[model samples]
Target: MKEYFNNIYLALSTIFIGMSVTFKHLFVPAVTIQYPSVKPQLPTRERNRLYVNMDDCIGCLQCARACPVNCIEIETVKKIPDEDLGLTSNGKK
Candidate 1:
C-alpha cells in the first residue's frame, strides 16, 4: 500500500540522514586534548580563579548550592547557644 511505501521511504531517509552526519564527522579530525600533558591556555582577560578563603567565607552555602559541578562542600559545626564566636572580618556575626 501507499502507507507501507511511505514508512519505508521515511526509514531510508532517516537512515541516510543519520549516516550522512556520521560520515561527515568520520572524515573530520579529532579535537580531543591530552589534558594531563597539554593544558589549554585561557584568555588573557579571564581571571581563571578557583580558590575560596575559608576565613573570609560568611558560612553562606550560596557558592556550594550554585556550583554546576557540586564540587564545593561546606561542613559547619553547631555553635553552643551561649558561645560568642565573635564577628567575622566583614562584621558578620
Candidate 2:
C-alpha cells in the first residue's frame, strides 16, 4: 500500500514540474524573427567569400600542394631578368 502511494506521488510531481515549465515559457516573448519581413544586419567587414592578394603571393605553390582535396591548380611563368616586371607594393622585385 505504501509503494502504491509513493508511485502516485512521484507521477503527480513529475507532471506538475513539466506543466510549470511549459506555462512559464508560454508568457515569455517570442524570440523567432519573421525571415523575409525582417532582415538581419551584417557587419561591414563580414567575409562571405575567400579573398587572395596576388601581389603578396610568393608563387611558392605551398597552398596548392597542401590542399587535401587537390582542387587548386596553379601555373607560374619565369620573368626575364632584362625585362622590367616592376616592383610590388612592398618594393619587392
What's the lDDT for residue 24 in model 2? 93
Q: Where is model 2 more than 4 Å wrong at Cα?
A: 36-93
lDDT of each: 0.83, 0.80
Estimated TM-score for each candidate: 0.38, 0.38
Tens-digit lDDT string for candidate 1 (33-65): 898799888888875435676767767887787
TM-score of 2: 0.38
User: Alpha-carbon error at 90 in model 2, in Å?
Assistant: 31
Candidate 2: clashing pairs of residues: none
